[model samples]
Target: MSALLQLSKLIDALSERIGRWASWLVLAAVLISAINAVVRKAFNVSSNAYLEIQWYLFAAMFLLAAGYTMLRQEHVKIDVILHRFTKRTQIKIEIFGIVAFLFPLVLVVIDLSWPLVVKAWLTGEMSSNAGGLIRWPVYAMLPIGFALLGLQGISELIKRVAFLKGLIDDPTEKKLAKTAEEELAEAIRAAAEGAKK
Candidate 1:
C-alpha cells in the first residue's frame, strides 16, 4: 500500500508538470490563430499547414492535459448529488467508476489508436491537404494521452482506496487555493453547474 501510494505521488507530480506545460499550449494556439488570420487577410496568403497546426495544438492541449486534469480532480462529475453522499460511499463510487469505466476505456482507446499512430509514423504519412503537416504527431497524441490518463487513473484509484481504509484524507476534498486561471475556470464551471442544481 505504501509503495502504491508512493507511485501515486510520482504520477501526480508528473501530471502536475504536464498540466502546467499544456496550459501554455492554450496561449500558443490563440497566438497562432491570431497570427494566421492576420497573415491570411493582410498578406493575402494562406496555407493548409497554418490551419491544421491550430487544430493540432488544440488537440495536443486537450490530449496531453487529460492526466493532469484527472490528477487535479478537475474533470466533470455529478458534484451536487455526489456531495450528498458519505465520503466513504463517494470514494467507493469513485473506485467503482475508475475500475469499471476509466481503465477499460483508456485501454480500448490506446489499443485502437496505437496501430494507426504506428502506421502513420512508419509510412511517413502526410496530410492530404497541400502544405499540411505530417499526421503522425497528431496521431500519436491519442495513445500518449490515454496512457497518461491511465496512469493517473491508477494513482487516483490508489488514493481513493487508501482514503477508504483510513490511511489518507478524503481524495475528493477541495484544495485550499486556486490560481487566477483556475478561479476563472471555476466561475465558468459554477455557471455550467446550473445543471447540477
Candidate 2:
C-alpha cells in the first residue's frame, strides 16, 4: 500500500511538472501569433511556417496538460448528481468509471494513434502546406497525451483505494488554495457585511 501511494505521488508530481511547463506553450503560441500578424500586416510578409507553428504550440499545450488537468481534479464532471453521494460512494463510482470507461477509452486511442505516429516518424511526413512544419511531432502528441492521461488515471485510482483503506485523507478534497475568483467573492461578501454592520 505504501509503495502504491509512493508511486501515486510520483505520478502526480510528474503530471504537475508537465502541466506547468506545457502551460507556458500557451504564452509562446500567443506571442508567435502576434508576431505573425504584425509581420503580415506591417511588412506585407508572411510564412505558413509561423502560422503552423502557432497551431502546433496550441495543440501541444492542450495535449500535454490533459493529465495535469486530471491530476488536479479539474476535469469536467456532472457534480449535480455526484455531490449528492457519500465520499466513499463517490470514490467507488470514480474507481468504476476509471476502470470501465477511462482506461479502455485511452487504451483504444493510444492503440489507434501509435501506428500513425510511427508512420509519420518513419516517413518524415511534412505538412502539405508550403513552409509548414513536420507532421510527426503533432502526430506524436496523440499517444503521448493519452499515455499521460492513462498514467494519471492509475494514480487517481491508487489514491482512492488508499483513502478507502484509511491510508490517506479524502482524495477528492480540494487541498489547493482558493482561486482568485473565490477570493474576490469572499472579499465582496465581507465588504457588504461590514457596510450593514
Give candidate 1's TM-score.
0.88
Question: Which residue pairs in model 2 clash with each other?
Answer: none
Clashing pairs in 1: none
Candidate 1 per-residue lDDT over residues 86-133, each given as its tens digit: 879889989999999999999999999999999999999999999989
Q: How much is 60 displaced in model 2, in angstroms?
A: 0.9
- Stretches off by above 4 angstroms in model 2 are 178-197
Task: Provide the overall lDDT of each model, using Cα atoms, as 2-decimal numbers.
Answer: 0.89, 0.89
Tens-place lDDT per residue, model 2, 1-197, is: 99999999999999988986786686678789999999999999998999899888888988888998898788898988988999999999999999999999999999999999999999999999989899999988989999999999999999999999989999887668665346545756887899999
